[model samples]
Target: MKLLMVGAGLSGAVIARRLAEAGHRATVIDARPHIAGNCHTERDPETGVLVHVYGPHIFHTDDAEVWDYVTRFETFRPYKNRVKTTARGEVFSLPINLHTINQFYRKTLRPDEARAFIAAQADTSITDPQSFEEQALRFVGPDLYEAFFKGYTEKQWGCHPSALPASILKRLPVRFNYDDNYFFHRFQGMPETGYTAMVARILDHPNIDVHLDTPYAPGMADRYGHVFWSGPLDGYFGYDLGRLGYRTLDFERFTETGDWQGCAVMNYGDPEVPYTRITEHKHFAPWEDHAGTVCYREFSRACGPDDIPYYPIRLVEEKALLSDYAARAAGEEGVTFVGRLGTYRYLDMDVTIREALDTARAFLSGGVERGVAGVPG
Candidate 1:
């Protein structure tokens, strides 16, 4: 079978490789001039430091298979993501651990006392919270929510905390212990050779051909035995049901001597600051030492047609619009929508690869169809 894969990112590369290994001819195409999608990374010409083109993507997952799968392409250096935040002219560790609780309240409370103190701060009045604001208040109280989440959440989603869903904040954990590890995943690390190199390895199979600077044309659907689309779900249907919402990013790169923020990522929780976080690229790959550092102050805004869409704003209105696109996509004769953009949902690299592997398996077993709509699972 000859397969056409649109978008040579993690999802497209993974599925293409899997199909090739299954003795199928797979050709991958990406609109961008490179692979790895948003996770694209390259060595800085000035400093020789690896830079994450879109944003910092620390590969962290609990799935052993995903971990091993990535390690196959590139060597990973041991790294743990420790984030910091600035609020009211003071700095604190992220994930709201014991250190943060003690410093914020100016109390020397132990583990048990800290837990009880946070519990006391929680608003018991709202038993069943609905919005992001209500959920944060009920869980961590007004002061913590105001300092840490309220402004940041508002800036990120471009809506009041009350308008956003509660599930967004629920994923973050608050602990009485001093564990400031950003992710709770069992396996966490950065690719030693950079993400682009890893993705290049994924597309290195003899049966796979990658076309950069190429956009998928609707006419190409007639040229392939099967089509796997990883572009925007709405774009595939020509956005007939109204444009889906997404929050894109603008990166302001700056050069610095020595360490910039002394951390990998620094969150500006204050509403006064427009950008969300600043990532120091060198800190991401700690094994290699570089004298000067490069950093990107990331600004989040409403995604326009020209900007690269980072996060999908799957609000109620967007969901309804996506449903219309999904219905139309179901009628596409030989296209399978895979990955983040294709499904119109935010997905990490591991989940994208896993889904691609599953999609390949389904195709081989004759269980997968072209023009399937929505998420696979």
Candidate 2:
């Protein structure tokens, strides 16, 4: 079978690789010139530092299969993400660890004492929290919530926490101990040669052809035996119902001597500050050394028509719109929508790859139509 894979990101690349390995021909297309999509990394022309072209993406996953799969293409160096935040004229560790709790409150409470103390501070009245604000207040209480999450969440989403879902705030781990590893994933590391090279390897198979700067639309489906679309779900349907919500990022890049922030990611968690975080690219690849450092002050805003959507804002209305799109997708034959944009959900790189692989395996097994049991409307 001849397949057309759209977006050429982790999902598309992995799907193409899987299909090609199964003795099927697959052609991959990406609107961007790059292959890795948001996770694209390249060398800075001026400073000679490795720069994450879009933003910092730490490859972290608990699945051994995913870890083994990614490492096959490119060697991964051990990298544990330890994030920092600047708030109230002070620097603190992220994920609300014991150190963060003690420093913010000016107390040296142990794990047990801190847990009890925080439980006391929480608003127990709101048992079933609906919004991000209420969830934070209920989980970590008012002081920590305001200090760590309130400003950052507002800036990142471009809205009040009250308007956002509780699921967003609860995504991060709340640890009583001092363990500051950003992700709890069993496998956490960055590719030694960066994400672009890793994805390039996945698309290097002879049965797979890659077309850069190409957007695969619905009309292109006629030319292929099947279509695997990783583009926006709303875009496939021409926004007939309504446009879904997304938060895109604007990166302010600058060159600096020596180190910047002494870490890879630093959050500006105060309302006074505009950008949500600053990322030092070189720190992501600690195995490589450079006298100069490249950094990006990441600003988040509402995603426009031409903007690259980074995070999906799956509010109640968008969920309704997504349901409509999913229903439509279920009725459309010979077209399979995968990945974050296609599914209309935020996804890590591993989950995207895993799902793409699963989609391809299902397709090769020949049990379903267009890799789905049914077609979309």
Candidate 3:
């Protein structure tokens, strides 16, 4: 069977590799000149530091299968995402850990003491937290919420925390102990050569063909046995219902000798700060040393039609549009949706690969045109 894999990111690469290995031909196409989608990374020519081109992507997941799959393509260096934030001209550890709590209150509190203190500060009035503001007040209280979450959330999503859903704050890590690691995943690492090289390795099979700078047309689906689209869901349908809302980022680049911030990621918690975060590219690759450093000040805003969409907003309005698109997709033949953009959800790299692997397995195992929507079971 001949398959058409759209996007050429982790999803398309993984699926195409699996199907090609199973004695089928796969053609991978990406509208961009390169692969890896938002997770794209490359080395800085001047500083020799491995730069995350799109943004900082720290590979962290509990799924051992996904970790093993990626390691096969590229060697990974041990990396932990320890984020810092700046608020009121003061620097603090992120995720609101015990250290942050103690520092904010200017008190040396143990884990138990810190837990009880936060509980006392929490708003008992908000028994059932409905929005991001309510959830923050219910748990962390107003001081921490104001210092850590409120301004950042406003800048990130371009809306007040009260308007956002509670689930948005639910995913945020708040540790009782001093552990400041941003993510709680067992497996965390950065690809040695970069993400693009890893995806290139995945699509290097003999039976796979790659076409960069190629746009996907609905009519192209007729040329292949099946089309696995990892592109934007609304984009595949030409946004007839409406353009699904998305948050895109603007990066301001600067170079400095030695280290810029002496940290990989530094969040600007103050709404007064125009940018959300600044990432030093060299810090992401600690194993490599350089005389100069490269950094990007990231600013998030509403995605315009011409901008590169980073994450789907999935607000109430967008969800309705997604449902409409999904209904239309289900009725279509010889086409399947996969990955974050295709599914219109915020998916990590591990989940993306796992679903791609599962999708490829189902298709190769005589499940032709069945269960190929790429939603993990």
**CA lDDT of each candidate?**
0.89, 0.88, 0.89
- CA-RMSD of model 3: 1.8
TM-score, ranked from best to worst: 1, 3, 2
RMSD in Å for all candidates: 1.5, 1.9, 1.8
Residues 105-144, candidate 2: write the lDDT tens digits. Answer: 9999999999999999999999999999999999989999
**Model 3 steric clash pairs:** none
Q: Compared with the true structure, what per-residue lDDT tens digits does model 1 show for residues 2-77?
A: 8899998998999999899989999999999999999999988877789998999989898898888999999998
Instruction: Estimate the lDDT of model 1.
Output: 0.89
lDDT per residue for candidate 3 within 1-377, as digits (tens), equals 88999999999999999999989999999989998888998888988888999999999999999999999999999999999999998999988899999999999999999999999999999999999999999989999999999999999999999988898899997788989999999999999899999998998999999999998865788889999988888888788888989999999999999987989999999999999999998988889989999999999999999999987887778777777788788777787789888888888899999989988887777674532253321
lDDT of 2 at 100: 93
In model 1, the number of clashes is 1
lDDT of 3: 0.89
